[model samples]
Target: MPTDATPRPTIYDVAQRAGVSKSLVSLVLRDAPHVSEARRDAVLAAIDELGYRPSRAASALASQRTRTVGVLIDDFHNPWFVELLAGLRSVLDPAGYTASVADLALETASGRKPVDGFLAQHVDAIVIAADLAPGTLERVGVPIVVAGLRELGARDAGRAVDVVAGDDELGGRLATEHLLRLGHTRVAHLAGHSGPGDARRRGYESAMLAAGLEPITTGGGATTEAAGYSAACALLEAHPHVTGIVAANDVMAVGALAALRERGLSVPADVSVVGHDDSPLAAYRYLALTSVDGHSADVGAAAARALLRRLDSPDAPAHRELLALDLVVRGSTAPPPT
Candidate 1:
């Protein structure tokens, strides 16, 4: 029946140990500026001695702010999110904000709404990095920022939301144009269903039309590797003479690689491949895929900055920013075999 009854240390205890007023201790915990180095050091040392942990819920209630941003990603499996997240943290961490991430794919698997989870946590704001269903953002009382060139849902629920994204349509055009410049005539695009994917597809089509060539498009909906492989296989079966490919993303390009190898074709020697996002996979020594660099990290940082702006001026008109993209040539692409 014995039970440990040691009471947990509180902020008052920290203030006593640090020999500072409760308000000064609070400022130190909040990391406010203008605090002297001596008092800050003493407060920190006292916190360590007492092993005191601040209560986020209590803090939020006191200040009416959580300073936490809920970031919803399309899929965690895609490495593209890695750079974007790093970019977001680069700005957010120094601003005394934290990011709480959730994956759309996982949320769907669990049959729960992704945005709902963020709201339940009482997050101060939400960053939409995934293409969510219509009305998903409806009735959500938090501020929002859409990242990575994705559109707000059909509901126009977030018409006032700020957006910071890469110029994906330009990225697609750059990838396709690279192959065209390499003397590739028969080019096929593996399209994806997302907002960015659709824009990239349009760029490819526009480039082909401008060159007086017909655009060959494949991939029904998803942007996954399996989808890419299947789309590539179908493209080869139908257009056996295709000499170049533009995949919607890097993973899809890798999928196309498998399909090409299975068909006994060599990359660059027989055909060339280009991908979007310029993810880590593209730089691998073995893959070395020619890819479109969307500067995902920059997009993330910009998005975080935009979110801060939205929080500061809730009444301000919505803003949209598009960062340009470029192509990185690598071993995966070359002039079509003569």
Candidate 2:
């Protein structure tokens, strides 16, 4: 029997085998609108025979639109981000746009700039949460929308970049006020770090001042369970009289609950606690955490919508949207002991 013959194919080989011009082959590979279906089909068939893959860089240069948005999150494992992503997908999926996510774990020691990777991919736009590394805006060539974050004074190439955020300060105030209304005078706040944390802290202070009470903050970094636990322990040690606590986020609140339990304290009795973010775990029957709803889903959806608008009209005016916050009273909170 004759040995079977096989041929390795390149773009040039596909062009020749397809009996089409190299330019036509290139256009088909790039999915350029200028090429007709008949020629595209012919080029595709030749590509299948040769097992040829088009160069992504060359194709991207030919087609200006990548149909992809870059999303950079501070941490990937956070449940808040998961909910935000769902909201983002609800808006972007129907519009045929996709997102590329970059997670920057606080523990990562790598000096690699994740923003550079997104730029290298030629993503059409970028959505970044709070606490982004400095200089990200300067390097990004495409439209950038700040989600759940604030950019103090970054130039936007004369085109206004959009920002979508929740009223974290208001949420903080609401949480504090709720605790105050429950007759808890010595309420301690487990404040998180940076951005949202600062805003919420301000609100807590404002609410306390308005109520003619002093604001006490147990400063903690990030909204982690460990941070909450540590902050709660510190608060209990410093101010044993404190009867209520408002954590910056649900994670910290859960930690506070655990801390209270470890101390042989009961929720809503020894120390009523309220958390921010209203994460899914907050609603569990066992936890029943009273928390502030930052409406992360709405913020995510608004960010996606803002990005699409910018993509459609790059020169459109810069916009800022602030979503509302609601207080969800659950079983975790109660009036201080008489």
Candidate 3:
């Protein structure tokens, strides 16, 4: 057995063991096409036997590619991004790309630009999962894939960006329609100002209008749980007759729950509630929030694939993909109280 001090194996050793030229070993390392199958197999076998690991730094220097992707998220507190990151890794890992994660919350707290951090890492590409300041992405000079966001306005206008997102508007409509189907006549929306939040609000309004019911909406600031709670409180104060609430996301839905509890209201019994983003919190026995599943993981995977394609064909027309959404029924929604 080799001790900790044993020197790591190198490509030269691998080439010698396989009795192949170093250039041939390099081609095999890159999985390059047109290499003879027999030579490729020999190189791979020798690499396995000798435990030779390619130096990513050296490879990057030669190819001008770091094989790293910067993933920017809104907040770590939100569980929605957990599945999204898993999906991104699913495709990126197999493609030999590493995901470097950063959250806007922390970046702002530290008083640094999120894009600056990603650029400093020399990432080959960037996957945006959060909203940035206007023009924050200008002149990034890197391929960008907007993940899980239906709209993004901050980017280099001259460059084409790939977008892979869930149909948030449809998801919002589905959640509101679910509540409407559950016999809720007085439905209010806990709104947020973000792109997804705005889209969801529009969906709720559309459903209510279609049903010929007056729509009540409140909260147009943050999408945090605190924001949800505050908005719910304000909504209940102004429209206490509301029988249902459609929050922008699961965290906000939880906030609304707290607001309901304070007013001695029971979920689905007093007021049925539906939330968007079927995050892990929605599945908790205590919450059991009926929510819209935007398939964020699938969005992440699709975004990664788009990023790879962008890398391969930089001049191709920008890819825009909108994934479908579904709703997960839980304990939070039911027929309105009699």
Candidate 4:
């Protein structure tokens, strides 16, 4: 090992030298469990050669609890995950828990299962912010908190998954209500194919029925801007009189804008638009889209709380929380023109 006088290296440096992810290094250092001998040896060697020392927070977690939580995201490409991650860290860091993020996109590309990676590190708990493949959590012997959009848990009796998420269904209803309140009767929905997407579409349909309007839906595909654009084109082709649109998410909503512009339509002038997630993209001066705020940050914090609660009482009654959602009116919505 290097002397105390030697410059200490960060975990990132150790990860680079070890040719492994930072979470793997953390697992090696803690000696929590389940790390392969080769990877553990490599990490140990890197630490000795580079004079790596754990942080004060990391050092404080010397207990039965590994004090680590694995955060699984659906895809790293989506910007909405940024705020949710920040919220998780905000509470986790202060509570002396390290949050390590991974994504299903990367896992599937490498032919690795989502839980396999976390299980290898022996994470004390897991936060599922994505809809994982079936069986990903079937036998995962750890406390799990399903955060954000998806509803997931164990199928077997005696085990339950704790869930904390924004009211996505309510968000859809709120978005539609805002457009309806603005005198938009010819409203269409840019659909997304996911648990959250399904809930949002149901909300839109319910609101439309309550208003004595028909629910026109399109794009039960991926949750991307491309899908949004394709959906918008289909909607416009079928119902050229559509005066408003409710997208599954902010990125999808942005996609709708491009399709609208191509058809000689202007936002809020020719057709009002609304989006979900209230991501940074929605607040851009150019987009300025009316959107539903899911309070992702708050949901993240609450999810952490739920995980901690579960960790303390594994046999306790299952906890489910859905934060209220609100619509943020911006420049993207206005009354339909005569």
Once superposed on the true structure, which residue ranges of model 2 sit more than 4 Å away at CA?
Answer: 1-63, 106-108, 151-153, 156-159
How high a TM-score does candidate 4 get?
Answer: 0.80
Q: Per-residue lDDT for 130-246 in model 4, tens only?
A: 987666687677889889767455552238778889999999999999999889999999999887898999999999999999999999989998999999999999999999999
List clashing residue pairs in candidate 3.
none
Provide the TM-score for each candidate, comma-separated.
Answer: 0.81, 0.80, 0.81, 0.80
Ranking under TM-score, best-scoring first?
A: 1, 3, 4, 2
lDDT by residue for model 3 (193-260), tens: 88788888998999999999998999989999999999999999999889999999999999999999
- The residue ranges of model 3 lying beyond 4 angstroms of the native Cα positions read 1-63, 154-157
Which candidate's lDDT is highest?
1
- Of the two candidates 1 and 3, the one with more favorable lDDT, higher being better, is 1
User: Which scores higher on TM-score, 2 or 3?
Assistant: 3
How many steric clashes between backbone atoms does each model show?
0, 0, 0, 0
Better candidate number, 1 or 4, judged by TM-score = 1
**Candidate 1 residue spans exceeding 4 A from truth:** 1-63, 151-155
Sorted by lDDT (best first), the order is: 1, 3, 4, 2
**Candidate closer to the true structure by TM-score (higher is better), 1 or 2:** 1
lDDT of 1 by residue, 1-338 (tens): 10125676889999999999989999999999999999999999999999877887445564477788999999998889889999999998999999999999999889977787887677888989998887788888878989976756423664588888999999989999999999999999999999899999999999999999999999958999999999999999999999999999999999999999999999989999999999999999999999999899999999999989989998788888999999999999999999
Regions of candidate 4 where Cα sits further than 4 Å from its true position: 1-63, 154-158
